[model samples]
Target: MKNTSQSETISIIGAGLVGSLLAVLLAKRGYQVEVYERRPDMRKNTISAGRSINLALANRGIYPLQQAGLMEKVTPILTAMKGRMVHDLEGKQNFQSYGQKVEEVIYSVSRGQLNKICMDAAEETGLVNIHFNQKCESVNFIDKTMTLTDELSNESRQVTFEHIIGTDGSTSAVRDAIHQVNSSQHDIIPLGHSYKELRIPPGKNGEFLIDKNALHIWPRGGYMLIALPNEDASFTVTLFMPNQGEISFENFDTPEKVKDFFKRYFSNVVPLIPDLSQDFFNNPTGKLATIKCSPWHYQDKALILGDAAHAVVPFHGQGMNCGFEDALNLVETIDKYPNDWQTIFSEVEKNRKINGDAIADMAIENYITMRDSVRDEKFLLRNALAFELENRFPDYFCPRYSMVMFHRLPYAEAKSRGSIQEEILMQLTDSARALDDINYSIAEKLIKQKLSRVQLNPN
Candidate 1:
């Protein structure tokens, strides 16, 4: 093997957020990084425009950006959101703070903007080259060669590299190639839920139509509509519903039906969204799913990260955050074994497989909680009690949502602790009328006994 210190030429498939950030990270470590994107560069041309998924940037995701020294520039684009602003069927609104303190809030950021920032950061390193309009058509992982197609000209080119990283997202072409080689261990599980995007335009004078600092949700029994504020004073609205069934996306045959459905269920939103009909008809509906793949790396030649390895439903708003964590985790693993690709790949797969699956499952569970449980009185009580416990026992208790969102806790740990915390909440709140009804003595005793202290290491 060549000296571990020798510069390794790394081919990165997909120039999206994860791929771009990985490029910056590796390039800073003196690796020659080649990044390829299938689409026209959004930094130059318009891409995804209105249909882009606006991201919820939390602590886990922010830590990675800070590590890359990109937060100094990226933080300016973020809009702080401290909690959920739930609007009822009657249009009555309520605020639910995400955390007890002032700094415990997520930021709303445009996905395209964040991607462009990472891409720019990578290119500025001079060691990274981002080839726009170049798509990875297929890969010969055995020989470590890849065929890249020019999307604009439909021309193909082949490149050889000892190492390849696939962050091309859930529908990854490189991953497909890996699947062709070994199909037994790779699977994409579909979530029955699908989502459609709508926009709530800014009011006159660029004023926000609703509260500007919170994530707004309209939770019905079976499905829900959520709106996250954007920097341009507009809000990105998403409707999550089943693909089939009476109350699903399949049932809304016409724009009129959609409007009527909205008027009946989300009546207040009718006036708030003036272009609701046009948007309902014009915008595309997207499917939600999770990808489960074992051995994320193939013999040290190729590896997959982010949505490619484990795509989760976006209910918990951790899909991007988890992907960011993947980048950080891999970077740390690489630091541990700077020159050993085989060891790096194996350790990454070992370290992340369970955490990835755990977050995916938790994201799915959160979908139900967001759409149905958010409005439930029992759910509210449990949430309140959970927050109370966190307030009382800062070291021993952290609400599952807070742990996942506010702290850098591992997803598997959060999910495990969350399950226990959830059971305790169910037991205490199952019959209690409200917070006053729950016995603090028994609750604190159970928490201290069942849950260990959450030690947050300083970053």
Candidate 2:
């Protein structure tokens, strides 16, 4: 199987954010693409809402979209989230800036809308064909064929492919197929926390009820509620809590319990959502998990990307961004080895697996930071010191979150560097209560001794 011919149709399973964007990227390079999606086309259908946690689109995601020329289409749908707006129990609010630079911000976008945009862009290229409602039932690597079943008709058909890429999400059929023949394994690490989505409708004048530029958080140590502003002036609120515990989702079994929980903890949010109980019961509680798989590819015939390969918890807001990076990296790999797909697949897996694992760990850590650490005075002091350190030593020091969100550095490198930076912050802030209380002499010595100057974007 000489898999690199541009004339050969590349079959991509799961016409999701990654797959759809990949189709556009491949089609641009003159390859014909066929995208198989199990769900109906969202543009033409009314898909159920409330399950999707609003995506936080950052620089890593934006760069790929810009490269694909889809940023123009995507920009209008984004709501810039400057930083976390911590909402205390007594209704007091504090804003924490994500970065000192004005440009360092993340945008909140609907997952479905962004997917639709990518799908539309892919179709616009005229070289990509998206077959909606066609579920990929199975893949046969030895035979180079797959079984696609029509969701509406319950009819199955076999389609041969030169190469297949899976972007079908965490519970991927394509990954399962590859697992049968490959020695590599995959793991799904659950965070033991579940989330449910609720909405805060626009005000009477169709204005935002909260600060439109920030992501709101009500961190309660054990459980937390977050809200992101949407394009329609509404806020998409999500509650993350344990699955089974004293203050878990199981405890809020009734409407009264749910409403009472909100009034007690998320008191400020209670007034915004009048039908809180109705929304709580109506929306489903979604699980939070990280999918870690080694060797996201199978020879020259098949590969997997995005959530299908590395699904991280949404705490870091890089799930979509990471998937988009995978798409970009794959396309770039194809560009380098245009005719040898086995090499390309091998290179992608080797390069991406570590980064994927790093982000997974960071996202899980961020869950705790968002739910508990943000409320601590020590945490705030260190966060501020991190920015000041970056200001003082531009090349040598960058905050871990900033590196992940604002730059294209490998997640593995970011995690490694962030670990060293954390040690520096701990030492610098161990005695200091504020920025003025800190000693620059000790900080400079520590940063110089432990860290090396880094290129912001190696891409």
Candidate 3:
């Protein structure tokens, strides 16, 4: 742990996952920390109203949990998903391993549950203070004051702080405040895709009907249905689709239309959803967005992290993972510059923006890969070859999915490495297909060269 100057007082807004985890990390380092959340303590509450997709905690997210020493407490609460179980139109299932080994598993945990664990951990630190139902309305950086309103009482209060950190969500009030103060550079671009959550209840015997070790998917060309395992032996399913103008609820309103749509498109999982029509009609559709901003910090007194800084789509299953990583990175930066808050803020802004933009692009590209490319014959063939390559060269040629989801490689670096691996696989496949003149020795030499290059320069 790194010690910071005693003069610095850090106030974090929003007790969501990133904010709460960051509060713990900062407090552990002997900093005076306060966290403000707009809603009540989630442990006492039921389902959060509009949370669409639950979290799929991969290596990046798990590493932070371990660092915070909360992984031991939360690991038992998650269900492991080792691979993807793809469903075909005829109800046949195809298994695709996420990594070479089954131990490289992604955990399926509820967003609310994970947040509660982080909040409880932060509270236990005793060096941190948590304020619930306190919604930050504005920030006065000049005066170093934050004005917050009580959601229930409709009363307002002001508090003074040396520095403020905004982990407030995508539609963050602190972000809005930053925009008001610094207008020219910030922008939040909303992706046109909207998503909705549905459920697949457990069987009568209280057992999983589908394989619990795998994440289930029903890819429908333009749209897709995905399900993650739950501790209760049920599954939380989500559907991603275009909003009102493209495939609006109006056209999908009636039970007959909904039934026809599901039966034609996602027949394998349609029957599992008991209230298919009602769920489709009643559930609120969530809009996806990617937020881009220059200079995430507002001078030495304040900075933003988490969704407030970068909000990517869920296709890559990395929104929360990236946010958790943000907290870890921010703490490290602060540790590196214990005396100079200005330098820490500047460095975080510079590095985080690059990583954020890289992930946003990868997330969008993954949407296409998830919803469309899964059905392509060539893509499937290439995936098979990649798996075989991984088996043959266990330490060297890992699939890009394994690197991104099962390893701690940065998204930008993963994209670059994955692109090179793809090209090598294409060349190898082309050579192998030309069996009239077999070139096994040349292909093996080429693969070894590529592996050596990756080992030398893994960035």
Candidate 4:
């Protein structure tokens, strides 16, 4: 690692979660950082409703907070979710533990609150300056200049920088500029699904209306409704369904239709959210997409990170965590190759692109698993067997979900091993209906033959 230096000034675009955290990390390295965000300062202004998704902070994300020395402040706002609480139409509930150990849990965090905390941390660094409502109109890589337009006044200003990093988001001006110069391929693949954010307010006397420790999911094969707990004893609930299907957001146009739809599907949840119809009609429906692009940097003059570079769907709840990982990796790479911006940017993209793509694919796959497969007894059986295998073969086998959530294993590595584990599970559970009926001898043999011993140091 290189020693901190104050000579370099880094201009970062966007003051969202990743950008704010990146500002803190860069400032800690003694770099003079300036951040420009298109949105108004959320702390001073009320955030726009319905667009915010509850973030699932896992080990990958928490490590960066720890590295930035902000975990102490972040912990209080986090609500630990140990498992998925699947609610059936009949109101029967099934809890699926995420992992074996107590520490193997993900956190439910409000995006707005977390972003505010990160911004506060960045400002506390004193070396970072964040300018809000300043939208980047364009970037001139040739001259190392960026044009920022004041959102309020529609006035534009030219800014010069030593180095520029864009955490702007999916629709990024920096990314558009980079693509103009470098002939790179990019695609925004829509999931054909949209989501509406609703709220489950607290009970009387500020009491939690439901279980506060688990992420609640009402899965209907073609669509799903998920709720994450908040510190205020309320829950941030999201409903994801197709945009124009027989049973979709398009189908429920009126308040009566919305109430009837909820009563038909998420019947148990209708009572918890008193103004369900109002929330459904009032909250805007947000689109879901996976944004992919290559050559994320432009000759070291500029680079983009987080959602600007790779935006995945939120099914796996790794969007924020993955972006945080990108920030962490970029800063670490800079430390490793100080003064070599080309190498730093190249290494950052090389290290993250494949992993980002892997997680993207996995996120889509998880959407199906969450919405459809969770109802399968076979899926539950495999999940249980995965835990047993990890316990039995400790070093050789770890479930893919566990590896992704709890361990520092590369996302690509986890996906690969998960495929092998899935095959093993299928073979082992071929004839068996439950864990008791499964033959241990075949499982041990298959695991030993298929998986190599791994050193897992989970966070």
What is the C-alpha lDDT profile of model 3 across 1-459, one tens digit per residue? 877765567899999889999998888887888889999877887648237546799988888888788988898888988888888788889887776676788889988878888888898988788998899999998888999999889999999988889999888877777777785476667777778788899999999979998888888776788899888888988888766654555457688887887888888787788988788788887888888776688878888898888888888888889888888888888888886888998888887778787888888888888777877666766777778777766566777877778887677777777787798777766635433333446656767876543341222
Quantify all predictions' global Cα lDDT against the true fold: 0.87, 0.90, 0.81, 0.90
Question: If ranked by lDDT, best first, what sequence of candidates would result?
Answer: 2, 4, 1, 3
The whole-model C-alpha lDDT of candidate 3 against the native structure comes to 0.81
* N/CA/C clash count, model 3: 0
lDDT of 1 at 258: 91
Q: Itemize residue pairs with steric clashes in candidate 3.
A: none
Model 3 quality (TM-score): 0.93
- Which tens-of-lDDT digit does each residue in 176-293 have in candidate 2? 9889898877788988999988999999999999999999999999889999998999999999999998888888899988888888899889989988988899888899889898
Q: Which ranges of candidate 2 are over 4 A from the true structure?
A: 1-4, 49-53
> Model 1 TM-score?
0.96
Q: What is the per-residue lDDT of model 4 for residues 1-459, given as tens digits with 9 covering 90 to 100?
A: 345468889999999889999999998888889999998988998876225656789998999999999999889999999999999999999999999999999999878888888899899989999999999999998788889999999999999988899999989899999999989999899999999989999999999988999989999999999999999999989999999978888888988888888899999999999988888888899999999899898887888999999999998888888999999998898888887999999899899999989999999999999999999999999999999999999989998898888987788888998999999999888888989999999899999998999756533
Provide the TM-score for each candidate, comma-separated. Answer: 0.96, 0.98, 0.93, 0.98
Candidate 2 has an lDDT of 0.90
Q: For each candidate, C-alpha RMSD in Å? A: 2.1, 1.9, 2.7, 1.3
TM-score-best of 1 and 2: 2
Output the lDDT of residue 346, model 2.
93
Report the Cα lDDT for residue 110, model 4.
78
